[model samples]
Target: MKKKIHGFIEKIIENDIKKNNQMILRTRFPPEPNGYLHIGHVKSIYLNFTLAEYYNGLCNLRYDDTNPKKEKKKFVNAIKKDILWMGFNIKNITFTSEYFDILYTYAVELIKKKLAYVDQLTKKEIHDYRGTLKQKGINSPYRNQNVQKNLDLFSKMKNGFFSEGTVCLRAKINMSSSSIIMRDPVLYRVIESKHYHTQNKWFIYPTYDFAHCISDAIEGITHSLCTLEFQENKKLYEWILTNISVSNYPRQYEYARLKLEFTILSKRKLQILIEKKIISGWDDPRIPTISGLRNKGYTPESLRDFVQKTGFSKQDSLIPLHLLESSIRKDLNMKSIRRMAVIDPLLIIIENIDLLHCENITVPNHPNVPTMGSRKIIFSREIYINRDDFKEYADDNYTRLTYNNEVRLRYAYTIKVTRIEKNKKNEIIKLFCIYDKNTFKTQPKNKKISGVIHWISKKNVIPTKFYFYSPLFTIKNPDLEKNFLNYISKKSKIKKNGFIEKDLPNNISCIPYQFERIGYFIIKKEKNKLTTCHQTVSLK
Candidate 1:
């Protein structure tokens, strides 16, 4: 389904702009470059950028790099790459650090107006004073620092006079305010550590609550959009900009973030998984990070299409994980080429091979699309079929191979099973069959063969690896669990060696192959070369 641009926020933007003749619809995608961007962030990026495009307004890709302790250059680079890969042409790139001087001026202005004060409370003291929802907070003892004294102390702190965690600047809002976030949220904190962008230029850093709205106002952003989790912080966001006397402050709007089922989008939890070595780094295909999904061969078109299908809404809901899978399946079904692969190989030898010569079958790459072209597949006397396709003894309803039962081999002749050989463990090792040439593209004349199977010519097959992926967690709602790692699936991945059609295009990028009767498989790369093929989804 195509996504429609009909959210209430869009309407609000249009109406507000029309009401104010001089106003413009400018927006920003402010991502804190602390970790790799996940699918949850994708929705926000799409919304902000698309809204700006639809309104013929300016959209900036700004990094809210306030927390120097967690921000990094690598994460920043990864973020830029992810956005570009998703097909967004971001014209303006800005950073909060770029406006550090301006933001510092605003903070000083707040202090001069007696709306903000430098606090000497310890970290725990601050938290304990910040009462819970049922209680009212208490003002910090140092909240009354005079303008001149506060200005000197704040300057010294910024000039590296104060040690980290000794003091912080706070807003002078009412302690008894009903909005807990308005009860004097921290505006700036002293951090002696170096930053990726600023290096050791300063010892103090502005907090997100202070910097976010101030930066938006400084850039003349018309709509300050964020996820609903920050609904409480909207009060503080407005307070900072209003108290600073900014000429035009952006209005903040909150929308529900993507909470996908069977997936966890919390960067902290994802870090834990990486530190614990539960899966590979952030690009592990099991996780839903943009890089992880890209590694799993998800197309940017599919991602954009998926985002569009889930229209903007204020309500939060857990979307089924299959909705994402369905998007990729829809795209691949039309574009992906077709081939035959047999994993868990069972060798089948034709009994009358001396009489029945081998043949070549020209099969279309796509069953429904002729322009996709065709690939030549060998139909030899000896071939490898999937072990699951055959049974030593079967019920009448079995649609696949059984002893003495004739079955149709996809794109080739029909074969009658004659015998089955077993190993010492009583496992079926091999199959012997006879081909009926008259059933090449049609069923038998006398009766119908219910069984239809897929095979690869053993003589002309290339052994390949197939990675079968399952849900990362055993349960659907692992995010709600106390310890999501407890539900990590033991069988999340199944590795099988298969024989695929020989001479598949080498050195080609992530092209999906439909393994005849099997599911779609995308090539897995090792240093930009094909290493194995991963099954994207099951045929069913």
Candidate 2:
């Protein structure tokens, strides 16, 4: 069962349904196919698809591929893959190029109705004439071109007579409107470049402002949702739909976009990171993209829970990145199996035990999840523990292994540090310890052992490389900085050598495992003898 969704948009939808019982609620997630989907896009996807499911309506996945210069078929396929990975089913996949004929017809209809005209001004001149918010726009000299001449020029534009930036189609709205978007916004422009889908069928393409609402109307979409940045463009959205001959006009709604701290959600900036080799690729674990999160061992359930926790609001706010980490931690805590790994190993030799002897011990996969079963691990006389777990001298609050103190070796027997072995440089090389054979699961009768540490048998250990990650940026709002690159964290990724239990399954799964006392980690096997372990999140 799913939780009831209650928001301002849901209330508006309910009122609309009440006004007209026959009305069918339809929504669509329209993304420009220029880059991969990030966490910001996931919020919109969750809203549109979940709302459709809750209201018993239909939601479509539409690609706003009007700009052929930056768009690609690979991006379209990647977006589809991301939506599927988020556990949402795409019922109808569409592209703005699919309705090129109908859109051109609609543009021609506007021209014949004297509502739109062809503009011969250069791009810069049009921008200067549009004016700023404090200044009113000036009417274009060719605004009153006769319908016949405008149609002839537009037809010539379609036939590739004009250069790419020479001419464009603009709506004939008021020049002095308070809203700048209403000041005769350009409807269509010549791209010259061949589209990935259309493939040189025509040289002209409709702008997003002109094609989006019409495309929504053609698909019978009832609610067209967008981020708050497009609140001003909503005027042009309604204007184009109202002037055209389309019957079904979709209403537009604006919500606050996701702004995460210590992250950059802009596709342009992400592209810069990729180009400059600041990171690996879009799937780099430090990035907020969907694929990156997946590669970092984040589950779909965790992302969905995060979206639900954030909800939908009209006011924009910067969300703390820790909230997202908390969701993933809660999810992995319940499902991940517990294992032992030693990063930065320190050798411990059991002087009292036989050097060649080994014993088998059964350990539960998860302490809380008894039904997950158990696995047997080899416990030999020689073992390796984390270097940080032991200290030559101890403080009163310290509860781990130290000189002359006894500590339990996790699920194995209790051991006491008898002496330390050091090198000529005064660095501790190893610790000689004696095990309490009578205290496997019981405490020593004469002494209190309050410390516990995880260890792996030297004879049954698998060498692995572990990757630790920190925040990509140093400051909270790096996106607000002029030079975000300056704030890039130098210690974002740190690699270390480690040893994992040898009884790991032959067929490695994508699911993360809780490395006892450390954090959750996902294993990646390499073609060589070594394996790589990626830390998903710290044990908080």
**Where in model 2 is the C-alpha error above 4 Å?**
none
Supply candidate 2's per-residue lDDT for 180: 88
Report every candidate's CA lDDT: 0.85, 0.91
> Candidate 1 local accuracy as lDDT?
0.85
Per-residue alpha-carbon lDDT of candidate 1 for residues 117-160, written as tens digits (9 for 90 to 100): 88899999999998988999988989897999999999988888
After superposition, the stretches of candidate 1 with alpha carbons farther than 4 Å from their true spots are 1-3, 355-357, 525-530
lDDT (Cα, 0-100) at 290 in candidate 1: 98
TM-score leader: 2
lDDT of 1 at 72: 96
Per-prediction TM-score: 0.96, 0.97
- Kindly report which residue pairs in candidate 1 clash with one another: 399-451
- Judging by lDDT against the true structure, name the best candidate: 2
**Angstrom error at residue 335, model 2:** 1.3
